[model samples]
Target: MTSSNFPKAERLLRRPEFLQFNEGASKLHTQYFLVLLKRNEGTGTRVGFTASKKVGNAVVRNSIKRRLREFYRQNKSLFISADINIVAKKGADVLDFHQISTELAAAFGRLRKKYA
Candidate 1:
């Protein structure tokens, strides 16, 4: 079974990495998010979450990010070996965990079909 732990190696943590990844990524747009996907030759997938000030105040932004991280952590197997950046839309802070999960699942399903 795939481990549930979200290790540091599985995250995009720096500005340069995000910028470089964005340069070559293909985008997937959902109702409450914008997912940027780029294939990587690395052995594991890496993900990053972004919630700009436009989304809400610090509290709301962090909540959105936490929800995104939880969804990714629980569904890591659904992703391929790629660098993915999930950016929250303005109203995403309004979603509950289940709603976020449902939307993200559909987005990832499309991603899998495309990259599979």
Candidate 2:
């Protein structure tokens, strides 16, 4: 079996280690996100995409998750070795994949710049 790029390590979801990004971490919208990055602990940069019921029905929520996953998977190298949780906001569902991808890419690029 192929190894999973998005591994569920302790840094991503463990309690007591929550490190949310500043207002700048979240861009293009008010949707807040938490990023926990480390140098050498996990295998690779794993990410989790979340969308609550407030967004819409199951279809809409899954769509958002799919877009986020695609955005991260396609551009995995752009991110550092950490666990990331992407929370969805009100306008998330209404936005298209291309739009979301652009925002996500820019946001992720910022993260990469921090390490570089």
Candidate 3:
């Protein structure tokens, strides 16, 4: 799902960036994960992914992160101009791409209305 049009230049990188977003970010929840949206003055959109030990081991957590990144890359337009961090819960370890996309779409719709 890598896109030439969507470069990685705008993504959240440093640990501090994640912390800054996580501090008081507006949260949108779904059964699969929690979407934290932090509105900032930055242009375009940035994203991060996280899954705790409760979710799974290192491999499972990494899988969740990869899938979440692909999901975000595909449906990024639904998210407004802000920094985003998605925290996956235990259930995320078993969910397929379709289920993850479904839940995240709903959450994104709510966030769009909220941050609009």
Candidate 4:
């Protein structure tokens, strides 16, 4: 079985890595988030989450990030070998986990079909 862990190697933790998406990434917009995806030469997929001040205060932002990370961990197999950045929009702080997951799943499904 595939491990359901969110390891360091599967995360985009640096500024440069996140900024790389600005150059030529494909963007997918959902009601609560903006997903930027770019194919990478690496075999594994890496993802990053961003919650700006516009989204909410520290507590709210962290909660959003945590939820996003958990979703990614549980559904890692749904992703392709790419670098993905998920940015939370202003109203995203209001979404519950299931709402966030549904929107994200739809967004990733489109990505999968495009890349497949």
Candidate 5:
């Protein structure tokens, strides 16, 4: 099995952490998700995932979160030092894995200039 290398400690868990990222964050929008990003103090990249009630029920939300995590895991070379929060938008719950990955890749590309 190819285990994910993502560190649990790098995840934004507390409300205050997420709140901090909310202010002055650069955003990338796609059909399936909205990616909000802020340059981070930490050495490596950190991330968080959120899906509102509008997205779907618990099962659907978890599915989106899983897809987001998988995208991040595979695309480490594209990242900068940042705190990223990905929020599932309407219709995201129904997206296939390839669709989700495509949107995520596009979002990362869009943020490249900003991160530099």
Candidate 6:
């Protein structure tokens, strides 16, 4: 089953069948999270978050994933036209929800301007 709740738009995903954001995707270092973004192709942007055992036990990793997913869920609409992915780096395990959300919003704004 497909996991995306966000709708896809052709102009941003199908029109550009390449991931150009790798070279320029903004990186935000927060006290609790590290967010990475890249533009990709498909029906819509696919997002994956990775939190290794080094961050903590399984519980910690899962918590980080949930926060990351929620961050994307709340902000995905802002970039409804773009296929964007946000990955959580090692630092993300330590972050609180509000901090992660703020970082995500800022990153989205930066990407919006770049893609525009």
The lDDT values for all models are 0.92, 0.62, 0.83, 0.92, 0.83, 0.61
Candidate 6 regions exceeding 4 Å error are 1-34, 80-85
Among all windows of ten consecutive residues in candidate 4, which has the lowest summed lDDT?
1-10
Compose the digit string of candidate 1's lDDT tens values, residues 1-116.
Answer: 45887889999999987897648799999999999998888757999999999999999999999999999999988888999999999999999999999999999999999999
lDDT of 5: 0.83
List the candidate 1 regions with Cα displacement exceeding 4 Å. none
Cα RMSD for candidates in order:
1.5, 4.7, 2.1, 1.3, 2.0, 6.0
Q: How do the residues 1-116 of candidate 6 rate in per-residue lDDT, one tens digit apiece?
A: 23344344322333233345456765655455555555454345555566667778899889988887777666666553433445456667767999888777776676677666
Off by over 4 Å in 2: 1-40
What digit string (tens of lDDT, one per residue) describes model 2 on residues 27-92? 333343323344435566656566778888999989888887777756766777765667787678
lDDT of 6 at 37: 56
Which ten-residue region of model 5 has the weakest summed lDDT?
A: 1-10
**Winner by lDDT:** 4
Q: Relative to the unseen true structure, what is the C-alpha lDDT of residue 114 in candidate 6, on a scale of 0 to 100?
A: 65
Clashing pairs in 4: none
* Model 5 lDDT per residue over 9-110, tens place: 668888998898658988888887888888877656888999998998999899889888888888876777898898899899888889988878877887
